[model samples]
Structures are given as C-alpha cells and as structure tokens.
Target: MKSLSLLNKLKDYLKPIREIIYGLTLHEMDLETKKARGNLDQLFMLVVFGDLVGLPLLPPYYSMRLLPYIIPSLERWKRSVLRERDLTDFVSTDL
Candidate 1:
C-alpha cells in the first residue's frame, strides 16, 4: 500500500542524510588512520633502504632490488623525512 510506499520513499530520502552524519562523526578517525598508515609506510621504506641516507641497516643488494618499485615515491618520501622541522611542526599532531 500507499503507506508502505511512502515509508520506502522517506527512507530513500534519509539514506544520504544518515551517511553524511556518519561520515562527519568518523572523519577525524579516518584522517588519523591515514596518517598512521603513511607513517608505517615510511618506516617500512626506511628499514628496506636506509642505506640511501647512509644508515646501512640492510644490505645494498636487497635495497637495490626494491629501488625500482619504490623509485616513484622515493623523492617525495625522502623530502618528507629530510625536511627541516620547526617548533610548529613538532607541535602539530595533525599529521
């Protein structure tokens, strides 16, 4: 009936509103997860190829093997790691 159809239409209209509210509440959590993932990725890359910066934790051969696959992001990652940090950078936990 008509009542059931009206209920369904109302639900369809509210679906987007419900998702928006859920997204708003979880936005911060999603940002933190992304930041943590980036940090972990950097740590993994460092462990695999720390020799590039003169920290020979791993052998050069293994690092070279992985170099090609990581080359694309290597420059950006290096810049991020090597960039100078100021007091504001230390204070900012947004990342």
Candidate 2:
C-alpha cells in the first residue's frame, strides 16, 4: 500500500531533490523528517526554482506529472501559503 501512495513514490522519485532542498533552505527548518516530508514542494520551489506557484522558465510537464498525487495538499498549500499576498498576511492569521 505504501508503495503506491504518491507521497511515498515522491520520496523515492526525488531523493536527490531532498538533499538539494534541505541544503538550500533556511537551517531554521530543523528538518528531522516529518517537517521535511510535509514541506516538499516548498523546499523544491525554494531550492530549485525560487518561485512559489509556478516557474517562468521551467516546463509545466514535470509539474503536471507530480500534480495528481499531491493534489490534496497542493490545494491547501496554495490557499494557505502561496495565495497570501504579502508579509502583512502573517500576523493576520494562524499561519
């Protein structure tokens, strides 16, 4: 069962990416395991593309491939983290 879940597949798919993400992000992340697991997309965008929603130069095909599996989290992640306008958003909510 674990083998089929997209999250687990993503772990295997992007193992190298994990290393890159952890190295580039703020050390304050304190990435033991679960935190890193939860924030994979954030780390990818931060470390590789430096964008939030979409990358201007990167092709959409890659994202398209991973999109289905991460859909549930993506929706919430976009709403809570990516959709917010600016720094003013921080103190406005529980985020």
Candidate 3:
C-alpha cells in the first residue's frame, strides 16, 4: 500500500515537469507542423476540386476519378476556400 502511494506521489510530482519539458521543447514545432499540414491540405483540395468554386486547374476527368475519396471534406473545403479573410486573420495566428 505504501509503495503504491509513493509511486502515485512520484507520478504526480513528475507530471508537471514532463509537461513543462514537452511545452518548452516540442509544442511550437507541433503547432507549426499542424499549420503547415492544414495549408497543404487546403492547397491540395483546391487543386483537386477547384472547379466547384470556379478556379478549375485539373481537368474534369481526373477530378471525377478522385471524387469519391474527396467527398467527405468537400463541403468544408468549399467553405474554407470561399470564406472572406482579412489581414488580422493571418497576423493573429502567428502570435
């Protein structure tokens, strides 16, 4: 019982230190990577389905071939592509 309690105490003590280390070393990189991935996904969607929004780059035959795989995110991609943005939208995310 005492050993279990000591182990619990040790874990509680180490938890914040572990989180601090992770925050200091890995958090910013993780956020940047996620941001990059989102940008890439949006760009890829634009390439694949831009016709729906009137900026057709790829030919229709290929877009039709890929339609099934892209269906789930189609609405979200359209909304994201068509939404209005301002300078503050870009500036605030960096901070």
TM-score of each: 0.59, 0.33, 0.76
Alpha carbon lDDT of each predicted model: 0.83, 0.57, 0.87
**Residue 54, candidate 3: alpha-carbon lDDT:** 75
Give one digit per residue, the lDDT tens place, for model 3 in 1-95.
Answer: 99999999999999899999999999989998998999999988878867766777888888888888898998998899799999888874644
By summed lDDT, the worst window of 10 consecutive residues in model 2 runs over: 45-54
Deviation of model 1 at 8, angstroms: 14
Task: Give the range where candidate 3 is weakest over 10 consecutive residues by summed lDDT.
Answer: 86-95
lDDT of 1: 0.83
The list of candidate 2 runs beyond 4 A from truth reads: 1-31, 45-54, 79-95
Error of model 2, residue 2, in angstroms = 41
By lDDT, the better pick of 1 and 3 is 3
Q: Which pairs of residues collide in candidate 2?
A: none
RMSD of 3: 2.6
**1-95, model 2: which lDDT tens digit per residue?**
76579787787869888777877784445544656665676665443342234554445666556556656665565565656476774443322
Stretch of 10 with least lDDT, candidate 1: 86-95
lDDT score, candidate 1, position 61: 88
